[model samples]
Target: MSTWTSRAALAGAALALSACTEQETGAAAPREVVVARGAVLVAAPPGYCVDRTALRDAEEGSFALLASCASLDPNADGPSAQPAILTVTVSGRDPETTPPRAEALAAAAPEAVLATRQRGALALVHLGDGGDAVLPGGDPRHWRGATGTGGRVVALALYAPRESPLAGAAGGDLMAALAARIEARAPATVAAAPPQARSGDGLRATLARLFN
Candidate 1:
């Protein structure tokens, strides 16, 4: 859908797994599910939300979908007690959409994990990190995880308040659920095969080839 820029590259690198940044903006546009022709389905958990307008503003030409947990008090002070965020982005495998630097990225990140949607032949590559990892310019207090499959990458960042801590398994389960939902809803014609869940070397090579 759009060319991958440094931000996208960082996000792509996140597919391998940071920061906590408070959103200063007001509530986002009404939350709604987006179903793209490429058989991409993007939605958030019930009670959770996505700022479609803000997300679009963040990256105009990109196919990234960002979802956040609904907040009851937009004016609350300090770190939010909001639920985690889920971001799903798809990079078409065509030469124009896929970038050439993916190979080097894969080489450097050797700890990617492979996952799967519950109902399809697609395999997902995931990289997860707690608040300890540093995101390019994001909040280091938030937990982040990302998965890629069928030329698509889905990242979920769980943002809890300092008072509430989220478990790693929770993030994993959420990612899996989203993957399953995507596979179930994708169109039959969008049959792009996913990468195999192998070691980092193989996975990296596969991703480099698939994206580049």
Candidate 2:
């Protein structure tokens, strides 16, 4: 968990900033990206699409950057439940491949933890003031999660702009969906659905509730 975010921090921020700069980009809706010669499928949630320019892959691993199709390309149209940036990293399952440890990161950078929970094999963390250690200028409150699936461990994060609703609980739900979606795409696992509804709120409202 730490290794994934620690490595992608700078790259994630850059990808987000670049996407924001391109008011008009991407020629088509992206397809599921294959990684590691059929080891993993970078399946993005519905209404979202991968930013191919931000993709990094090797023979057995990959990092994918995703955002609303519209954000990637104005001409592309899709029902994005929340406007935010997302990242997914897939590596061969190993001893180091464990569930996300929000409390662990909190131990190292308590200021970055908003809330954290572990559910069975999956672990998730809500982050605030994580800009220093996570995504700078991102919604201080972002969401990250990790879990093992289909012989590999998947790590993913969701970053919203301050005013975006995804800064709320919906962010966690989204990351979980990303994890589940990846497992569903694995050759061994049965196919599952990818989707979401919507949320209506912003960072200030969330902060008030948290600090109040």
Candidate 3:
């Protein structure tokens, strides 16, 4: 009707639009953590080998990749006689309610020893019985642990004994690199899936594929 009234209405519409934009920006952005070719994320430790494709394929639920590193005895004068082991675990969103998954994982891999439990967010388990330690003069060990979140959890444990120096390092390094890649790619909000009977098999297969 009146030019002044028209101007006022336009101004009000602009203000409303601005408010809506602000609201949209304030909401947390959804992020996908899986590493793709040419995707720049965090760098892995020096000399560490990585298999990005295999890691992404193994990803289950919301759990994403994280940092991984291999512990080798730097003091050994000769070729390392023990294999280095790397363990990775993913937890669901609700740690308190994730026990069933953990139990399933424990059941699937009876050799994995229970290492420790931290509230609902995390649990630690060893994969191999104490036999050959990775660290020189240390106990032979291969272990892994997991924590819970709201979504899902995944844990990966790897070992490379000293006898097979190159293979061991390669395996350990690949796992560690994959962990790093996962951490860099996945979002923190993504929780690990509950442990299922196929969880171990899937994890082992994923690792084998990565190395193979």
Candidate 4:
């Protein structure tokens, strides 16, 4: 080929590559949110938000995170029904083996215990009638689950107004669903820490907090 033609072809190829790079650089990235002691994560659900400000520190070994689906839209003018709350708690480094759902419920000294049942994939221990005020604000319902996998154990609970759609069988099913989402990424040894993948600034910061 002629020198002029070869030069022209190479220049065109370079321009095309630069354009591709620019397009990729400007593309939006996927969104993600972490939950349940950072053991479970899912793509940030649309219209759902997490409230981190009220994270409960029951003790050095225990903490809870709450997520809500409350509507933030201002245009809708109508009665605002109570929003559903999903609460997840993690209990770390407990010397005692994880307790059975029944045992945990009995230990709580609840005013009354209800029959144990499976909802979705989780067997839940009903804490008590939602009227007991075990939850803040005298909430109507509370339920608990103890899930262990890969030698890591986490106890999860959900507190909601009795009127919530997720208050009954639905709540149990939701608890089961969330529990199943826990990732078994617990490091088997100190030397086996997972390598951090380079990510965008936001993801990098989120992961730092999660893993640290």
Candidate 5:
């Protein structure tokens, strides 16, 4: 038997709910869902300090926005099934390949299916299957793709279970809304540096290196 897992699955539920209500109007409705004020601080991966205030937890699931003054994971070799900075991942069993399965899953739900890319044996799907009128980078799922300034910002990812209460709820607008909340709270800039360079020798040395 094949297994499948997606970190975005939980977050995708919010998209399903939002998509259900917004399909016709193409506008997300106000949610009765009460969100806590300020961002919730969570321990981020080493070498990166995430804005916990960027986190938005709802009954559907949760979304977190991260800002790295330095690199989130300088040595992150490639995508892993495990959760890492700024990436939503899913791993499990399925007869189909990653992209096809991801496409089918997104289609079944109210998600906005974005493009798919193959990473070795895995297929990575970049989607905007949530609420929020404007994502960090405009909707990649759209035909035109991103434009101008939207091209520079990193994309905010969403996840959803193949079959869950949140799946196919709405057009995934709520998920977008959740993403918007996170984006609204994210830092304006993430400094760039050479791949092998460190922000500060001490800071780099003390930083916990993940993805071993």
Candidate 6:
């Protein structure tokens, strides 16, 4: 498929799967999560925590929702809590395939890419209004990054209210920071759940869950 086609396909799939939820991941520290058949280990950045109640591990892939630690745990005094909703999606990697490259992603959807930056080993793309092919209409502005983990491509996305750090130029730095800290662990057994890819009703629910 063409680059644009691949990019759209990915976004459409993610959009479709956004609404469907999953079981809690039990308690864990530093918020380390094994997901996507173990293709990715989502480690919450400082002051943030994984929302166990909002996770998906199924045939479609692994999805983790992240929020300020203070929001998830009333007792925690998250001094650095960021005003943003972060998500990580781990697309199961085929042994025969390589992780998506930074340049490749930028190239895939040029019209939407506002800026591309190389952060450590991560290449981040800042999307313009309605630009992110990953989650359209959810946020006018967002950041996206991809990296290889456990033979899979870990997709990172950040959405924040206007005037928030995650919605400005600093977004790339945040994305890179989170990317550098993420690690890959042993593949966990796939959950016996239905496909996260859902119907039109689910899509509307997803938009509400995300934008509201």
Give the root-mean-square deviation of each candidate in angstroms. 9.5, 10.9, 22.0, 20.5, 17.8, 9.0
* Least well predicted 10-residue stretch by lDDT in candidate 6: 203-212
Could you tell which candidate, 4 or 6, scores higher by TM-score? 6
What is candidate 6's TM-score against the reference? 0.66
Candidate 3 lDDT over 55-137, as tens digits, reads: 33333322122211121212213222222323233332222233233444444453544343332433334444432432333
Best by TM-score: 2
lDDT of 4 by residue, 22-70 (tens): 3233232222344333443432233333333323333212233333333
CA deviation > 4 Å runs, candidate 3: 1-49, 58-108, 112-114, 117-120, 130-140, 163-212
Residue 90, model 5: lDDT of 15
- In model 2, which runs have C-alpha deviations exceeding 4 angstroms? 1-5, 20-26, 95-110, 132-136, 184-212
In model 4, the runs with Cα more than 4 Å from the true position are 1-48, 55-62, 71-82, 94-96, 118-123, 130-139, 186-212
> Ten consecutive residues with minimal summed lDDT in candidate 1?
53-62
Q: Estimate each model's TM-score.
A: 0.45, 0.72, 0.34, 0.52, 0.25, 0.66
Cα lDDT tens digits, model 2, 1-212, are: 12324456457557756775564443674846766445567777888888877877753456788888777766776575567778877654333334445565345444557788676666787877664345555567777666665545566677787767788788888887777667535544312211112144232222122112
The superposed Cα distance between candidate 3 and the true structure at residue 95, in angstroms, equals: 10
lDDT rank, highest first? 2, 6, 4, 1, 3, 5
lDDT per residue (tens digit) for residues 1-212 in model 1: 12112244345334322211343366433334543344455555445444443343211123333333434225433333235445554433322122223233323333342322221332333333333232343323433333444444433334332333332345545555555555323545445433333343333433333232
* Steric clash pairs (candidate 1): 16-127, 19-138, 19-139, 19-140, 20-139, 20-140
Which structure among the candidates has the greatest lDDT? 2
lDDT: the better of candidates 1 and 3 = 1
Evaluate candidate 2 by giving its C-alpha RMSD to the native, one decimal: 10.9
Instruction: Name the lDDT of candidate 2.
Output: 0.62
- Give the per-residue lDDT digits (tens) of candidate 6, residues 1-212: 12322332344335333422322233332366767655456777788876665667743456777766655655555466765667776664444334455676676553478888765556677777643444443456777677655544566777666667678787777777778777865434323322343334332233222222
Q: List runs of model 6 lying over 4 Å from the truth.
A: 1-30, 131-139, 186-212
On a 0 to 1 TM-score scale, where does candidate 2 land against the true structure?
A: 0.72
